[model samples]
Target: MGLDAFVYCRCWQDGLTPPAPVGPVGFDEEGYLSLVVSGGGYTETDAAFDGWTASACPHELMEQASEHLSNWTGHRLFQQALGAAGWSHFPALQAELPSANGGRMPAEAAVRVLDELDYFEQQAVIDDEVVLVDEATEAVALRYVAAYEGVLMLGPGYRAGVDPEGFFILDPDSDPPATLFRSARFRQRVLPSGQVQFSDEKKSVQIAMSPVGDKGTPPEWLRLEKQHQAPAEFGYIVEPLRRLCRAAVATGNPVMWC
Candidate 1:
């Protein structure tokens, strides 16, 4: 059986004992957070969560929120840019810079570089390693990315043109307001089992699309077209969840995912 997850929030005043575990873990109609799992579960009582006020986010929701923030920040692109700028390995640079105080680079310049490096590193980790996002999280991220990209397709100047080799290309240059250019870079190939596989490699990943009429648009693009008309609704759900994670972190609350 699959594991079900829940998010919760807890707060206590001075001289008052922390709230005892009550109902199951879940969101109730009255906006209360509970922990009553069908099979029963225990809430973590880490000292980090013992603050005067705190919120905990579910693992799945946290991953989804992270995906949203990553896209918004163009984190992957930023990392690639960092590499191009001669930062061989960002994490290594981050660690070494703090200790290499005797180097030729001035302390102030090093600090500035460290600050910018830290931002990228934090965005890359997003409070934790993304590898923690299991298959379940991957499924959610794929669907959300697809739907988000679809909604972007409805904007003016979004032209769906086929590359000469029948590969689909969403030309953002044609669409002035298109921030979804990265979405177009993803290529999809339908396996014989009808399952769609996605990749970003244009040359390494073989395209299974036949060079017939329409040049075979990736199903992902079609999904995006279907979603393009309802971008706001999509954002409404994802944005708040992202903010919840941010708020939880801001309050020094550690997000626990099962």
Candidate 2:
């Protein structure tokens, strides 16, 4: 069996308790404004919840959205390009060129060329290499090799600031406002038996409204959307959840996943 994921928003009140796991529930387009259990339970039952609710988005949808969002929102365009070239998987390339230091030119030299040139300009230098497979794959491999070399230049902490959390938060009222989009806060919990769970405690959950396109959206995120050619192709999947978030925020309710 695969891991289950859920996304819902509940109204906030001073003494309200968290929603109990009554069983499986489905949310529709209008948002699950009222909680209804199949076994004939009152809307105010301890197990049921009030306020806006959206159908739970699939875990895979969240994962894909996060990946695309990262790629589009990140300022490191070169690194993104390198990733497209498969740099993380294959870092070395076979080429026939002499090194400036003396023997055959190593992968390091190819990387330097990549950093110094734009996409089109790098093609001239790459043309001299021995055919690795096909022209397209070889070109991508060469770029990856270059990216690896560039990372080496940054020293040990090149990746130190990378966010380990997997989800992005979108709070608009933050001090700087833009700070909300800076890092991911969603994290995975590892069980003693080595099983992994993608869930968070109520206290740890951060507040964020969905990026459903509005004037309230942060400028930085809007630019990313334009730059990446509307990278949020899967936005529809999260629309309901976004609506739920809006309702929760309006009612001062907390959103949680189980």
Question: Which regions of candidate 2 are displaced past 4 Å?
Answer: 1-229
Candidate 2 weakest ten by summed lDDT: 218-227
TM-score per prediction, in order, is: 0.24, 0.18
CA lDDT, every prediction?
Answer: 0.31, 0.27
Tens-digit lDDT track for model 2 on 72-101? 122133233434444533242112111111
Q: Highest TM-score among the candidates is held by which one?
A: 1
* Cα shift from native, residue 53, model 1 (Å): 11
- As a whole number from 0 to 100, the lDDT of residue 77 in candidate 1 is 26
Clash number for candidate 1: 11
State which candidate has the highest lDDT.
1
Error of 1 at 102 (Å): 36
Across 78-183, the per-residue lDDT of candidate 1 in tens digits comes to 3334444446435443332222112222223333444444444344322111110112122112222221332222223333322212223243454344322233
